[model samples]
Target chain A: DQQVKQNSPSLSVQEGRISILNCDYTNSMFDYFLWYKKYPAEGPTFLISISSIKDKNEDGRFTVFLNKSAKHLSLHIVPSQPGDSAVYFCAYRGSTLGRLYFGRGTQLTVWP
Target chain B: EAGVVQSPRYKIIEKKQPVAFWCNPISGHNTLYWYRQNLGQGPELLIRYENEEAVDDSQLPKDRFSAERLKGVDSTLKIQPAELGDSAVYLCASRLTGVADTQYFGPGTRLTVL
Candidate 1:
């Protein structure tokens, strides 16, 4: 069973618009959630993260919202740019062993 | 500082052959992890090491896979008699001990077993 899931396989948006990616998890033991952006031929790079204690975390144009009760989270990019087009993955940091469980990922395309 | 480094960006071999992928983590990082990412899937952890000791390898297929981290800085993962299902991208990540749970990843080695 997949503990984390990204139901949307891809999302496309226009430049200067908002891009929202959704993710859900079944495990309650996950306390830390993070977003990673990956480009072609490159490894994933860390983006914004939100702890269980906070409902939202923002970094520049990226914002992540967490709804612990519903076991859902979403990453929002405001005024998305072309460079932001890539595969976005959501990960949960397991309480035990400190390992991360990742979602399949969402391919985001920001058009000019 | 240089990010994690992985060699053999791409490899193609017939089924039942042996293949190996190498990784060099960032300097002074004590925690290293190896993950396998199949097509259209996210990365799954195969093994984890704290320094030279392998702390977790429950997901690794020991029957045909082996890994070693000799000096706690660089690691090598080998698959002997690789099967067609073994085709995937192998990623290496490292993190400093006691730091935030962020992991720095390498470019990854894409392996295709024909």
Candidate 2:
């Protein structure tokens, strides 16, 4: 049973364009959500996150939107750069506290 | 500060062999977790420890998988008589004890069973 899902396996966009990655979850108990970026042969690094209480959170060029009613969230990278090319995983922290449920991940490629 | 550290970046072994992966969490971190990630899939939590105590291990396959955190700072995961289906990446992550604290992940150990 996959609690979190990222239907899109890959995405392509031109540099300086907008890149959006979507994620959905089944469990409503999840209160906090985060996005992690991973490179080849490296561990995932924290990108951005949004709490269920808020609808949107923004950090510079990266923004995360949370729709609690739909159990969905999305990461938006404005003016995407070639350096942004990597696998992005969306994770959720439920009421369980320390554990995180991760999605399959989406590979985003930005072409210059 | 340094991130989580894991050894044996890659390992290849035949079926029925025993293998082990080790992880060292970040300094001052109290929560450590072990995960298994299959190809084209997300990482699945195998076990989680708070200090020296395992808080959650429901997903662990106890029959063949075993784990330990002796000093509450480092951890080890072992697979006995590994099967071909055991080919996957083993990841270890750590975080400070709190709500919504970010988890720092290790480079991961890739295991291939022939």
Candidate 3:
């Protein structure tokens, strides 16, 4: 069974607009959540993260919100640029072994 | 600092062949991880190492897959008698001591078993 899920397969947004990606988890053992962005034929790069203690975390134009009760989280990018176009994946840090359970991932396209 | 490096960015071999991919992590980083990613899927950890010791490898297919991390800096993943279903991207990542929770990923080695 997949512990983390990203229902959206793809999303398109205009440059300079807000882009929101959503993720859900079925495991309560997760205490840390991270977002990674990946380009074609490359490895994933860390974007932002949020701990279970906080409901929100922001860095520059990127912000992540987590609702523990809902078992849901979202990543928001304001003034999204073409460079932000890539595949976004959500991962949960397991309390045991510190392993990460990743979602299927969402492909985002920011049209210039 | 230079990022994680992986060699043989792309490889194609017929089924039942043995293939190996190499990786060099960032300087001074002691933790290494190997992950597999399929099309439209996220990365799945196959093995994890802490300073040359494999701390976790429960997800690895022992019958045909094996990995090694020597000197605690570089790693190799090999698949013997690869099957057509083994086609996927093998990604390598590394981090510092007690910092393996957050990783820096390599470009990955794409493998296609015909």
Per-candidate DockQ vs. reference:
0.85, 0.86, 0.84
lDDT of 2 by residue, B1-114 (tens): 898999999999999999999999999999999999899888888999999999999999999999999989899999998999999999999998875478999999999999
Docking class of 3: high
Candidate structures ordered by TM-score, highest first: 1, 3, 2
Worst 10 residues of 1 chain B by lDDT: B95-104
| lDDT of candidate 1 over A30-95, digit per residue (tens) | 889999999999999999899999999999999999999999999999989999999999999876
Higher-TM-score candidate of 2 and 3:
3
TM-score of chain B of 1: 0.99
Error of 3 at B36 (Å): 0.3
Off by over 4 Å in 3: none
TM-score of 2: 0.97
* All candidates: TM-score: 0.99, 0.97, 0.98
Number of the predicted model whose TM-score against the real structure is largest: 1
User: lDDT at A70 for candidate 2?
Assistant: 92
Best by lDDT: 1
- Model 1, span B4-100: residue lDDT tens: 9999999999999999999999999999999999999999999999999999899999999999999888999999999999999999999997987
Interface root-mean-square deviation of model 2 in angstroms is 0.7
Q: How large is the C-alpha RMSD of every model relative to the true structure?
A: 0.7, 1.1, 1.0
Candidate 1 ranges beyond 4 A from true positions: none
